[model samples]
Target: MTDTALSLNTIQVGANARVGDYLALLKPRVMSLVVFTGFAGLFVAPGTLHPLLAAVAVLCIAIGAGAAGAINMWYDRDIDAIMERTRRRPIPSGLIEPAEALAFGVTLSLFYVMLMGLAVNWTAAGLLALANGFYVFVYTIWLKRRTPQNIVIGGAAGAFPPMIGWAAVSGTVELESIALFLIIFMWTPPHFWALALYRAGDYAAAGVPMLPVVAGPEVTRRQIVFYSAILAPLAMTPVVLGFAGWLYAVIAGLLGLAFIALAVQVWRETGERAARRLFGFSILYLFVLFSALIAEQALAPRFAGLPGTGLGLWG
Candidate 1:
């Protein structure tokens, strides 16, 4: 029995050398946001979903997102090795070989799409698979190295989770889903550019042509503020459009103010520290903003039919 156990352990360790590292290639932090936004889309859509099916749909979305991340790491290994931000990623760090990461991503992508089709509806599953493919083939392969607008265009990949979630619930797309998609799509540029402003040197080192690296920090700061200005109104649109409650409206308004204030500070301050501060605050802004939506939704049942509950828009 001991000998057999030792043999099995040996096999596992050897297999790790071949395949384990590739799993680390997936950017799990990014995947978490994808899953969260997808769930939010599912929850907010005006429909019922069997809990089991909802769980399966979210799971498949997560796996598909991770697959895209793995493929991204595989493809970006060259520049990743030079970028301080990505130098330690699996493929660049020598923990995983690029081919292994590619294979892992491809396998998981196929599996998730097929399983989603079987477990959920084909439309939702197909969209999920398409998002993965777009992230890998379009963003990573075509856009990243070639263009400064990489993030602007590639942001669509990240924005799809909510759409995917909406599709999972409705089995179709609609204006509401498109609204959710637009909100995130607009939100992404300012959020990422803040990071890019502070990390311009890293991007320059990596040859990644991020806006900040190419356009200069001051230009990036102005762009960040500009985008934040655009996003501020868009954030409140749900309220105006009668899609959210006052609770969400108030939260969105307050967070939007804070977000704009941070961007203003970033625009004025000429230091990396300020950029870092704005970057951190941008993340909090997004989390709190989304959380407001979830919270209002949760409280809606209790507040239903109350006069002020639906008052002043988005109720």
Candidate 2:
């Protein structure tokens, strides 16, 4: 194996000098999705919140997510150094010491969870902390290197945001929160497996057993289609369960079908070019799917006495 530490040696001395590298270490893109989806869940919940407290809750979730990402980067530094797609990350590229990343992540994790508990409620804060721990201890350290099913099970970390949001608003969990959780949970596999299909070489070189690497491209492709088939209807369950209305149903149905079709095409693909297309489209599919949910919940008119009234954000 190539010397993993050598990748860090390539960084210019004091390379993470700017404020931006530290911010980049926090993985803002991933945090943004966490924060937004959590907020949407809060909005959809059947209650009012102190706006400032709700803001603090979302902020805590975002920081906690970033902290987890930082720690994940620290632990995965070796594999990251080997992967072409991740060779330039701050830790792998030596812009930030792995120890520094670890300390930063731990500190933020403690701070966010504690502050959230004190400022909001214990339930939301607990979920945030649990997600951080699960991502690091369960996904990064254990399952990732051991099994191809890692992402499937470990995806619970990513799906926790909506549950956290719902808890923040309601100070409890409920059926609708589970629905929101299921939406993201089901969406995770196909989305990630699509990327794995395209990036199988990088994963294989790193000695990581991604689905596409361990099972081969054909098996991964079939699994993606199977997961997409399951995901399509689950994405629309919120509407069926009465948390959302017809608008959401229509939009989610259409997007879910499109997602399945794309996965089917990907199943038939034989090489990198096709995998790349599927990978790119999967990101778009997720964004569109979530955006449709937000739009239908926030903008569409509501029926009488239903939670979709204009008084709250989700109506």
Candidate 3:
């Protein structure tokens, strides 16, 4: 028997994988962000979706994202076992078998995509399929170990959720949806690189070529600042394009400045604390940006006369 088989056998003995262990394989926290952004896309799209259909769309997105996370855990078990932050994950910690995780992920992927096509629309289903495939085949298997640019390029997978959500409602991809996609795409590098700065040691130990480990922290910090600069203006695209109102513009402007300021702090400081701060705030920054969009959309009727109310633009 192969050593890997023997190891699996040994780990399987007396193993007690539970429901929560299975959930852990899905990476719920990451799934939450995906669902939120996907919902934002759906909510802000120009057309209306039946509330029931809308719920299905969001559910499909959440499950599809979780499936991708599960597959990632299965494929990266080796590196995950090596990384301190990931060593205790279900598969690596022997709470769940690798093959089981893979099968679970594959099943969920098929379920969500097929359901989306049947219940929602084909365009949304196709995008969900593409996103699942990209996260699994492209990001997890292709770029992760081979390139420092993995997250930069693979971020497209995450960026697809909003577009899919928009398509779910509009039944087509549009310029406005693309704007949402760009906002997330451009925000990814700086957000991830900040975490990479503090987690360089973990990534290096696992042999994953994250930017901070590959090009050094100094370069990573600078890149963070560069992306933040571009993202600051990019966040205001909805207002510039006439879909968003002045309220969104003002909120986005203030948030963008804060994002850039934090990025600059990361660039100037030599300590990991600065990187950690950026990492924490990056999550908040995105949550707030999208929240502002959602709020504006919800409140548009009541505040129609206010400047930049985002009221009349939707078809």
Candidate with top lDDT is 3
Instruction: Tell me the lDDT of candidate 3.
Output: 0.89
Winner of 2 and 3 under TM-score: 3
Q: Which runs of model 2 end up more than 4 angstroms from their true locations?
A: 1-16, 308-315
For model 1, residues 77-102, the per-residue Cα lDDT tens digits are 89889988888787777766578778
Tell me the spans in candidate 1 whose CA falls farther than 4 Å from its real position.
1-20, 301-315
Clashing pairs in 3: 245-308, 246-308
For model 2, what is the C-alpha lDDT against the true structure? 0.82
**C-alpha lDDT values of all predictions:** 0.80, 0.82, 0.89
Q: Please give each candidate's TM-score.
A: 0.89, 0.91, 0.92
- Which of the numbered candidates is closest to the native, going by highest TM-score? 3
Error of 3 at 186 (Å): 0.8
Off by over 4 Å in 3: 1-15, 301-315
